[model samples]
Target: MRFIFSVLFFALMTFSLSAQGFNNGVSGEKTFTFFDKAGRNQATFFSTTPLEDINGTANGIDGTVSFDVTNIAKTIKGHVKVEVNSMQTGIDLRDSHLKSPNWLDAETHPEIRFELTGMKDVKSEADNKISGTATGNFTLHGVTKEISVPVTFIYLKESEDTKKRAPGDLLGVNSKFNVKLSDYGVQNDIIGNKVAENIEVTFNVVGTVK
Candidate 1:
């Protein structure tokens, strides 16, 4: 009886700490921000350039991301997977155009992936916005590129949509990363694609706690 009580106590304590630093072991949806060419109109350009995918949480960043401060490193690494077909722009035509051979070519390679390399928490020089520089290898269109994106991570608690109830829940880190289409060899391949040379990709991801 005493041993069982001790086990319960330890479990409760671990959960409490996990809840406090949800960003550490918790996973959240990833949001991406694709940019447009320097010369383009954005008024009719609704954010249809949207995709739906989530990472495996801190594991998306690294296998061992402890909440403790001293153990923290200059960077955390993780893997992210995105379903290229789940993109929605509120406009079927635009979405289809994007998914067609002109842009994403989703039929051939239906997923976009990234592996986190390093993170630099700093304030941006352009807007003074506090951001972290997460450098990683992004594989798109069956091509991989090493890119650095500035992300602002805000950690939050689990949603009510959980099918299984747990004593504690996951951690959600809401973040956005932007990129240009031309940089990744998408523009030339896209036929008559009025799609801007700059394409913004975002992630709304959720990661399960370990």
Candidate 2:
């Protein structure tokens, strides 16, 4: 009985401390708008296979986030989108091929998007930051799949230094996740040799409170 009570007490303490660094006594829902500030917001995709490694970056990343610092795990929601045609693989010909009908069909699908529905396993880190798994519906090539992305969020209060970048408070977000091409109905010759079946994606962006 004593052991069980001790375990329960530890769990409760952990849950209480999870929000330690996230709150600055300000508690409310803040709507944040994400914008492209000279390509400050970006998403990159990488694929590696035995034959070759391919990587690409998309500079056209924009989105909005509705977040509440006090109730982060329950009240965080947002959507991020990357323009399909903006993806560049460093090679013009390969970039063209990647957007062609046989590949991503950029004409039919003009954007890749992720809609954040909720968060899980949230824990506060140092420097007013928090880490968690962001649960969202990821849309790619006209297909939508539920994916969980491990993400870190840093909240910065408004200040003179931040005004140089934008207005209001700033939120920095960094996320990394892997997706299977076949799961999204992307099947091609490049999957086996030139590109890996699974592609790794990284997203980094900052948002200004609205």
Candidate 3:
């Protein structure tokens, strides 16, 4: 009777372990492109000028995201790169000045990039949407700073058509954050007067699983 009871207990433990084995794993890689048709990847800065607020946009934004659906916090990784010269503020002369040595120095630093380091305060929302604060390293003007960006993620399940073409899930992400221009050593007396010291950056990215 004791042997029979011991065998049953071992069988139950084995079943439990097997059931929990699929709880944590990494999902496939996904490539995300920043849709800039309507000036999506843009930065807005308020200044003392009465003319108008500066709106600089980038059309070249490309990145990748790897997510773990089971363990959302443990295996979320992403990196995005934007071309510095792609930024334009409408005025040709002003745009040229922005790319010159005094401002963003596009010739020196051609690319602005962000790499996700960690995430916190993650909350799952309705309709496959997830909200969280992502902490990452933002590099601009040859300087890197750690910034926390609030992001919303929406996961789209694979449909029959998607499976035929993309073969994986689609993930949409939106994020917004503010940064000080001085933090990246971007300070000039003339430009500072027109451009605000703080700049607001925003991102709307869509990713496809690999």
Q: lDDT of each structure?
A: 0.47, 0.85, 0.69
- The number of the candidate with the highest lDDT is 2
Q: Which stretches of candidate 1 lie over 4 Å from their true place?
A: 1-75, 122-131, 155-169, 188-193
Model 1 Cα lDDT, one tens digit per residue, 1-210: 999999999998765433332233433433222221231111111222124221111111222221221111232556665556766555567567767876778899787777776665443222112245667888888789998876644433345653242213332334555566667667533223344445445443333444
Per-model TM-score on C-alpha atoms: 0.54, 0.87, 0.74
lDDT, candidate 3, 47-73, per-residue tens: 434445666666677677665564455
Clash pairs, model 2 backbone:
none
Best by TM-score: 2
In model 3, the runs with Cα more than 4 Å from the true position are 1-50, 160-168, 188-193
Residue range 1-210, candidate 2, lDDT tens digits: 999999999999756755633766556788888876787788999987677678889989889998777778888889999998999989898888888887899999989999999999888886478898999999998899998989998899989999899888899999988989888887655523457778899988898898
Instruction: Give the distance in Å from residue 182's predicted Cα in candidate 3 to where it truly belongs.
Output: 0.1
Sort by lDDT, top down from the best: 2, 3, 1
Least accurate 10 contiguous residues by lDDT in model 3:
17-26
Which should have the higher lDDT, number 2 or number 3? 2
**Clashing residue pairs, backbone N/CA/C < 3 A, model 3:** none
